[model samples]
Target: MCALKTLSLFLVLALFISPKIQTTTFQTIKPKLSILVDNSKSISYFKEEKNLQDFIYELKNNTRVSDKFEIENYIFSSDLQVSDSIDFLGSATNIYKAVTAVNKLNSEKKAPILLLTDGNQTIGNAYEFMSSEQKVYPIIFGDTTTYTDLKITQINTNKYSYLNNKFPVEVLLNYDGIGAVKKTFSIESGGKTIFSKRMQFSKKEGSRIITFDLVASKVGVNYFTGSIEKIKNEKNIKNNTRNFSVEVIDEQARVLLLTDVLHPDIGSLKKAIESNPQRAVTVSKVADFNGNFSEFELVILYQPTNVFKAVFAKIKKAQCNLFIVTGTNTDWALLNAQQLGFNKNFLQETENYGARYHSSFSTFLQKDIGFEQFPPLKDAFGILNFYREHQDIVLQEIRGVETTQPLISFLEQEKQKIAVVFGEGIWRWRAASFLRSGTFQDFDQFIGNAVQYVTAHKNKARLEVNSEHIYASNTVINIAAFFTDTNYKFDNSAALEITLTNKETKKKTTFPFSLRNNSYQIALENLSPGVYNFKVQVLGQSHSKYGSFKITKYQMEAQFTHAAAFKLKQLAVNTGGASFYSDEITRLTQDLLTDETYYSEQKAIVKEQILLEWKWLLLLIISACTAEWFLRKYYGKI
Candidate 1:
């Protein structure tokens, strides 16, 4: 009785303190079995939709299999989705994507996968090469039928072509029929036939590559279709034709390299600017140059001195873009007196400072190309100050101390977009970049982007968009937009929406954009095949932008006439799992039930519970008191 009273008093003390107590209990966690069903339109195209549905129904309804393992159902098309609804209407088949997704989501469970697919993956990397320990048991479907069909396996063409230039087109053709088949392969654009050739394919020689060239006379987006004449009674006619597009440009931008002296840096700058096929660089000395300064889109003054005074005057009057390079030979006094864009207060000596990246530079999105490790550039030793509020791409680091002085910077003050590199001897940087990255692409690309930004016209528009010209059917349209305030800073509070108008249906729809990662992003779905013209407009502002993209009437899932069982079998064998056909459901279930590799595991689950919040604990305390009192009364001690 005294012990019972002590227990009651302790319980009361625990309730007053209100301390949380944790207790660990063990429970059996059944090993998860992940089912990745290919809900792709290819199954429906192969006429095996019913067969796949029946197999899924039987497997899901099996009580014995469900009772043994925790089942996770997923479906895949162009991408993977966790779903119980199987409509067999997925537009693409990416088995590798499905398997990789399951591996990631169930990384802890290391769940065994049961994949159901025709094995016709139209996108993503190869599944057979995926490195994971989780076993993948692929239930192969659509292997029973083989139809006579000819397919345009692939079409290769360039994304852009110079005007009036002949662009090459290569078509890969494949025929699965038993005999030698002949078909008329043709190319069409704007509903008119452009090129035609007769191609032959046999069972032994089942594929052929036909290459031809077409003249790009027009200067705009040109759509083309490469197709083979369909054979008699062809079931998979969707794969008979392939559509592609090319953008034709009129001319390249002209850039003149005007320098007063000759240096290796001049060669490096010229080569870097010319690396982009769109920009042509012409090197000329200021004294010998007699061309029209305004003809060139940009003029690069290398190590400019008093000799470039007349050239700068002409360029300033022209209002053309300028990329100024200063070094040991630069006449800073004259350049500062001219007051083009920026001024540096340098001492008599030229100092060598290391480069430090500035992450807050938002004039453009550029990755740090490992500039901090490169050899320092030579600039006049002083407090290099800017006249305007400029953005620095790389700041100066004197010895080990990072300074506020700008090494490479950009400023627009005198109605001219100017980029200045307050240094020289960057030709050595090419070799240093190659030594670091095994290639000069990083350095060359950085230089090219700097030059491109300087030469490119200032886009004062408040709205900007980055998107593709074409998208495949059933793929999500991810349109990204950037809305800025009048001062050109990104505005997050702005209400931006996109209005898409279908060219064919004449129907318009609007969708709002969500803010993510400092940008306005929107994902659109269920858009039909047509050319969509979209306008991104700010709600309360008059600023708007327009663009168009074509959604092709193409489905990757319908490109298959039969299943690829061998690939799935190889994948299963590589992952320590067995491959079975849809008819082998019984054997698959038995293997799962009998395989000791899969079993429930006991795991300790520790849960924190409050002392006074448990109603059952209070009842137990009362029962203890009541029992103690009843015993004491029965013993005549009440």
Candidate 2:
């Protein structure tokens, strides 16, 4: 009876007490050691692949170093990657990018880095000048000794030029010989030397810059090769020659601004049309004009009077595009009689009308541009009545009351397009656009879009391809295309494909463009240096678009023959680390093992929980109480 009573009482008391527990443990944290190996093609040029692999193998296998630190392996060429690729076939070497990547790893324990490279960077900023909190120990590969070499370091030139225009080219030549020498620097085009000059270099002055201009006589794709005379027994002649390309275009459309009187509106129209590089504007008085009408794509008739009768007759005969602007000075009677798409009824009285953008206008994509806030334009109080069905882009408002009269309208009939602006003083609108947006781009784009629509070809293309004409060898080239239906609406079901052909090798490659972001696009990651022509077409359609692009011959990895020991040394010094050669792997491993600053850390973890909630303890208490109660019940007499 006493045992059973005591056991039950003990269980009740323990549950009420609800004791807590405290558990302590220790954890060992190892210092991080980041190892970056170079996989760029420059390492193969220097013949350091074997040395790099040997160093990585030994460093990872060293028992003492492994025990003291947590080692991580990384590979880098132009970018940093997690594993090792010993192929040494990367196109570029970017040491700074690799180092920056190491710094970005999420870790509380700062790690020391091991960099292996030829110390030559083809892209990114200079690595030696970069600031870092972690120490960088650089292992340089290849010959560190300086040699006598004459090289072309850099070249600067324009990628585009007009026909018969001169483009400037600048070349930077450098020498590393101890004695003074004279050599010839020449530029060649079409297998002929177009320019040559003798350059003298001394030990004190080993660099020379040559700048000159070349005439772009041919219409398309002019390539030039610049070279420096090589000294005898030069170690590497790969860098002695460099080449560049310029695309000469001659298809700029001409715009004739024909006006009877000089006004600010004429200059504004000219500036807006010329804002587009594909269009050129020439301003002239309509009475004094005597030029070939076949050369111009669009003609601006500014405030025309009786003197413009002959010009209008010529325009109608040629079926050319026209932009007519009218104001107080315009002769409405004569203009209405000429039957130029619209008729105006007005008196000599003038009035100012505010511009109101029409929401339903679909002639072209119009920018809002805060048209309601623009200064009112001056014109004779009149209403323009279009004789043909047209689009009204802007309407006129008088005394804060919107009217049905159109301000800017477009009409197309009989293969000829005519756009009329009822009011003048558009120059003020241009100034207001600048004042609001801080740039004339909005106003200029608005004007340019309208002009483009007026001058557009009758046979519009269904598939439009957009791409630059030239690209460097290192950059990623992409071409995009947009396909539209008969109503100029986007068509997404049709598949688009393109075929790229190399002009030099006569080789052709086909690539398909995937629909992305409402446009079909394709990425051409790597391409050889040459002129390439491409044809893009819809699979089920008959129309196709043709274009061409050029890739410059640039191989930054092959430009340098020796390692950049000085840059590596400076990088090590700046980061408070040490520099080592390829054969110094053993020494590096020993230093890492002996360094006391980077050591293992011990962290203690403590945990606490309610002891009463333990399942095993609760089960034991219940079994003891039940056994005691059973014995008491069996021994009872009553």
Candidate 3:
């Protein structure tokens, strides 16, 4: 009876649960995507009817047709002022800042970006943002031609102005087109047209240069706008207009100069240095060397009385260039040791007892050589002169030299190219020129040129690496270096050693390199991945350049793993769900979203053997019959 009851229960459970198990399958769910617009400076160029806000409305309705994605919106210009009711990422329209914000998005797992830009990245670095791993879809909308229009090339004026003073002004204009084209242009300053002219350009050349001279009549930074007549089919009109700000100043490169003794020769030299703004030279009589040397890039020491060794040492240590002016009091032995002494054979000595020195433009001081002759001055005492043989240096003097020196020389020193002026008496040239106009009255220019030559060698050296984590497996790594030595002539044979040092262990390895252009590539395959500091030293015969490089800590997994897995899991848990493995994807995706009776009804199915029911019962009946037969047979008639 118990067996029969268990069979009935098993049959009932199977009948109720089988249909529910076969009811449903699974499917995937998609998330919403958001779009942000930058309605800042770039938008102002377009009319109000064609603004970015209206454009956003168009994208919203069009994107709504796709049921796979939900859309959210946000807008920003100078600041994040407003956000829609939807949860959206706020953004700054500045190209660089916007890229940074989008690159950092953590919530949206699979998102797309749409960017509309003029390609004019003014405020921030757009290229840097795009160089990263972010996916950017750009719709460029600005003018493409760079320099095919008439533009202002240069503006020459002071920074401050006087209310009604006439000042010299120059404007340079260039037309960027092949073939000759004639056009009329005008210059407007302070809301008034100061000059206008019709110009012509040759069709064969790239650009034409136009010069204009105008008078300043305002007392502020006068705004000047230059515009040429608009041409038909011109692609961009905005670029055709050029503007500049010019200030009228009471003084220009005004220098206060002093020398220890009232020497005319020294005065001439100082005056020559301050001649042009190119590199102004100023001299102060240092009764004592207490003032700051920071004000000047170059300083001159025309022989001092009771000169202290400490003073010479201080001058040597100065950040600025120092030109030592030799006099009769200078120690000749020390001068020769310092490589400033001149060979007596090079001197041009005068023998006449009664003689007059006349200043004339020497072939050596010609304009091409960078020297200008001072105005002719007579009655100068004839003296011995020890000068350079280089014709180039001579032309520089003849072009116009207000300051005169008896000796000038150059020395190729270790790590430095030193130029020395051995003798003085330059002030006499200035005094002699004052008696006559047109003698290089610009003594300031002469001295300024000399000083510039001495200090121009101090270059700005800065180094930056392209990447912080250079993979050890990488065969070669690239580095970008920037320096201010525009006139550098690099020697290709120079070699550099780059040494990488482990941060914690202090272990170091060095790689030597021969130059392949201005770049150096060192193999990194042998080095293990870790935080390392690299220092590069360039070896040159005279001077050496040094820089440092840094390698960020590297993790092998960080470079190769899929970054999206973590975010996918977070989305699953936060929504009260479990992540599905790829193997079980078909079931999890199809069934998880289906409505099922199994979850609603409490039922289960089970399987059993027939021996527990029909077979066992039959065996029991046979055994009972056999026992009765045996009892009857044993009793009487078997």
Which candidate ranks first by TM-score, i.e. highest? 1
Off by over 4 Å in 3: 1-36, 40-55, 58-97, 100-112, 120-130, 140-180, 190-197, 201-220, 232-242, 252-638
Give TM per candidate: 0.69, 0.61, 0.30
Candidate order by TM-score, highest to lowest?
A: 1, 2, 3
- lDDT comparison, 2 vs 3, better candidate: 2
User: Whose TM-score is higher: candidate 1's or candidate 2's?
Assistant: 1
Q: On residues 1-638, what C-alpha lDDT tens digit does candidate 1 reach at each position?
A: 98898888887776667788899999988989988888887788777888888898999899999989899888888788888788987766777767877898888675899998888898767777666668999898885567889999988877677899998888889999898888899989988999999988889989899888999989877888888999999987988988888888888889988887889999888777666556789999888999998888888889889888787788778888888888999999988877775677778898888898887675654568888998899978877656676779899898878988888998876467888888998888888888766667778888887876677666666677767788878877888877777666678899989999999888999999998655678998889888889999889889899988988887777778888887888998899999999899999999999998888888999999875775666776798799899989999997
Tens digits of per-residue lDDT for model 2, 526-607: 7988889999989988979998988876567887868999999999999988999999988888887787889889999999
- For candidate 3, write residues 220-247 as lDDT tens digits: 3455667777555554455455555555
Which regions of candidate 2 are displaced past 4 Å? 1-24, 106-108, 251-495, 514-529, 541-544, 551-554, 604-638
Alpha-carbon RMSD to native, per candidate: 8.9, 13.0, 30.6
